[model samples]
Target chain A: MSEMLAHLSLGFGVALTLKNVALCFVGCLVGTLIGVLPGVGPVATIAMLLPITFGLDPVGALIMLAGIYYGAQYGGSTTAILVNIPGEATAVVTTLDGHQMAKQGRAGVALGTAAIGSFVAGCAATLIIAALGAPLTRLALLFGPAEYFSLMVMGLCFAVVLARGSILKAFCMIMLGLLLSTVGTDLETGQERMTFGFPPLSDGIDFAVLAMGVFGFAEVLRNLENPEARDVVKSKIGRLLPDWNDLKQSAAPCLRGTLIGGTLGILPGNGAVLGPFASYTLEKKIAKDPSRFGKGAIEGVAGPESANNAGAQTAFIPLLTLGIPPNAVMALMVGAMTIHGIIPGPQVMTKNPDLFWGMIASMWIGNLMLLIINLPLVGVWVKLLQVPYRLMFPAILIFCSIGIYSVNNQPVDVAFTALFGLFGYLLIKLGFEPAPMLLGFVLGKLMEEKLRQALIISRGSFMTFIERPISAGLLLVAVAILVIALLPSMSKKRDEVFTE
Target chain B: MSLNKIEAAQGWRVRSTQDLAAGLFMIALAGLALFLSRDLSTGTLRQIGPGMLPKAFAVICAGLGALLAFNSLRYNGEKLSGWSWRGVIFVLGAAVVFGLTIRGFEIGPLKVPQLGMLVSGPLVVIISGLAATDVKIKELLIFAAAMTIGCALLFKYALGLPIPLAPWLLGI
Candidate 1:
């Protein structure tokens, strides 16, 4: 315990320096500024801003980038609340109840709850990382390719269960996502399986391009089609602070969400993506009045927001302790670390204790800074809702264009994004949810790689999955969860008939 | 919003037109993928070929899509909606125009010099602005100019990204 304290105090010492604080503040400020924009998520925000940090030292650059990540997360939630558009898959859960709250003149409460929930979750998660991160790294390393494959399968099953639509349709979307991931060149064989002779596609589709087209551009088209639904929140913006009762209701869920998010975030291969979805599902399942969930439930906003921040924070453990990036944002951090000539591994802690602890300690300060930064700014964000979609959407378009183009100086990516936007609009028209597909797109490549590796390790023996205890356990859980989820929905549908 | 139109069928109408459309779309997509990957070898499990997953996933996608289509006939579900041509055309056209203008494109004999952000930025704001039914040229043009300038200063100057403000006029 004393050793941990000593390390933390050292971290604070480095992080508290005037120049570092200024960098952290700037990172958080700019991260929020750009993240609050519609369609731009944390990853995109970080990618776009990466070049700016090139001039700074490694530690200061990372601190600012970490601050930017947290800022973007908070800002992403703000956008979700006001506009009903989630910048990324994690924020999708936030939009469900957050936007509904906005439409009901409770936007301020939702925003407040999100900010508060995030702060609490962030603090708790940071502490967890500091305490458990080292030990957990050993467990994470124990995951063989088979274990990873099984874990991902379980995650997909959970996704299937949580999907509001038919299970078959969800499967279809997941499969489609997997198919899309196969479009690029094969990692091992150097074969372009699905690129159709396009030189640009040989590297596979960029995640940012797909996200911008689907979430940002397609949203504009959907909103343009329905002006009434577009400008929904004309009612009064309530108090900026959450009322006592609001806090009272959100307190427990905030903690529960943190726990759920933190656990999932620790898993490798971007497990953090599932945090909000899992928390939202748990909240709805346990809610006294489940029907109020998609409408404007405070718990929905509180739980998922907490879950998202916690998951995101814990996800940093793998990156800081080991070289593995848990998600795309962490992957960018890896890129940043590489450019700075710091290889991220266990050596990071032993070799550069100050840098490692400073980054983590800076995350603590960064979270506090976000709460301070976002509390007053929530009002400004709400006022943005009053701007007509006419002006707002054009701005979204320009920003999205710039954000996407800024990633790679390639114009073709923008054109491809436009095409995906059309594709997304079509998917909406057909009553298909895009969230599952996006999730599938993310997990697709990882799943295939793991499956291939597992098979190779087992030398084509399918039973290797069952032979391994961890893999077997995960697959068992996956099946059990699937069956359990199916039973409730079936019974519920039958009960509806009886009630009628 | 598109009209929830159920096309007239012979004896058995598609109860869930939305599902039917989705099923059809998925199947077509899968079939296209299969065709594209026809020549690729699906190697054995020991050393799986690149084609293994795609071909396998495409086949399953087709199967699931067929199931969705069949379910559409049995279960009552949502009808497919209509599309917004105006939003589709102008919004996407603006994005394409931004892409073409931001960096000059040369295709075969057709060559266009780079217009940079000064030209591309306002073009995007203005072209996309036209998607609105009540777009005002006066206000939109003003907004466009202001937005373009703000973006130029912010992206090129403040952030110091290598994006050119005006390449032909003033080389960066």
Candidate 2:
């Protein structure tokens, strides 16, 4: 515990530096702006802003990016409360009771509860990362290539379970992503796998380009298709603070949500997305009047908001400790870290303790900054949302184009983005979820590398994966998840869980 | 027979167009991948080559695609939604124009002049703005100008990105 404190104090010393604090503040501000804008998510925002981080130190860049992430989560809830539109997938559940509360002239209370819940949850998750991160890193260091491969398999299965709509479609998307990940020249051999004679294709496609194209450009296309559902901002935002009764009711739910969110966020394949949905289900199940969930229950606002923030914070664990990104946003972080020559993994903590601890420390400071920014500035965000989609989308397009072009100063990347945008749109039309595809893309390269290494070590014996205790346990879990998903009754229940 | 009765009679055999299209696309892509990587060395299992994973992925994709296609016939599913061609064309067109303008493109037989303009940002904004249902030219023009300046200041000056600010003719 003393050693932990010593490390934390060192982290505080680094994070509290004037430049780092300023960067954190700027990241939170920009994150909130991006989050407030309907259809603009942090994945795209981070990808767009990645170029700017090139000039800064790694710690500052990551601090700002992390700030943007949680800030966006907070900003997304505001839009959900004031207007019915959810700015991101995590905010979807917020729209249910959050919008209803706005209609009842309790928008301020809803917003306050969300901010407070998020702040508390963010702090709890940060501490959890600090305490458990060292131990997790130790555990991750023991993992061989076979264990890593098995863990990724388990992660992909969890992704399928959590995906919206058809499980078969999700599997296809994951397969497609893995295919796309193989587009460049083969790493082991100089042989070109699928580059089709293009010179630029020798290097694999940029993650930033792919993310911006799919999440940024395609999202605009989807939003533009349905133009009728414009922003309907509630005119009256009552008191910003919740009453004593409201606080009393929210306290337990907030704690429970943080626990649920933090645990799930440690899983692979963007399990953070599942946090809010799970919390909402839990809240509704435990509620005496379950029907009040969608009709303006304070518990609904408090629980899911806490869960979303906690999950957002804890999702960094796998990225920081294991050097594997659990989701697209973390994939962007890996891109950022690679640019700065700081490889993520167990070695990050020992090799660069200051960078590691500084980032963890900055998260807590960022959460505090969010509380201050979100409460007094609620009106500003609401006013920002009143901007029409027609005007907003063009700016997004220009930013995306510029961001992609600036990455390599080559127009070819931008063209690739445009092609991916169309592909993403078509996938949407065909009812395939793009999120799993992204996870698959990020993991595919690493999984392939690990599998080959393990195979080489084991001398062609496939039993190597099952022979290792950890790898066997993980593969067993993956098989269990698949078996459960394939069962007819369980599959029906799974569909109901997602659709509901 | 009425349309409703025909639909009822088809029942579980009725396939969703969306699923069918998606399934076929996946299968085609897998086939293309397999064909492309067929010549690459697949080496032994102990020392697997780059092509091994691609081939493995191709097989899995094909199997999943077939399964999805089969499942479509067994369950009722959503119909494919109408495509917004105007939005699709303009938005994608804007990105293409931005790419071409940023670094001039040239083909031997059919030639479009290389105008390596830095005004790609504003050009993209204006073109994509037309994708909206209601396009106010005056508002769009103002937005385009403001965005161009904002992007120039942010990317070029502040961030020191080497994006050009004007056309070659301007001689800035």
Q: Which ten residues in a row have the lowest lDDT in candidate 1 chain B?
A: B1-10
Interface RMSD of each: 1.4, 1.0
Query: Candidate 1 docking: what grade?
Result: medium
Candidate 2 yields a Cα-based lDDT of 0.86
Retained native contacts per candidate, as fractions? 0.75, 0.84
Docking class of 2: medium
Tens digit of per-residue lDDT, candidate 1, span B1-172:
1123443233356788999999999999999999999888899999999999999999999999999998787667888888789999999999999998898999999898999999999999999999999888899999999999888887778767678778899996
Clashing residue pairs, candidate 1? B2-B82
Stretch of 10 with least lDDT, candidate 2 chain A: A226-235
Tens-place lDDT digits, model 2, residues A1-500: 77778888889999999999999998899888878887777777777677766667888888988888877778778888887877667888899998889889899899999999999999999899999889999999999999999998988888887787788888888888898898888888988888897888888877777888888888889989987475455558889999999999999999999999998898877789888889999999998899988999999999999999999899999999998888777887887788788988899999999999999999999999999888899888888888888889999898888888887888888889998999899999998878788878888888899999999999999999999999999999988988898788888887776665
- Model 1 misses residue A400 by how many Å? 2.2
lDDT score, residue A160, model 2? 82
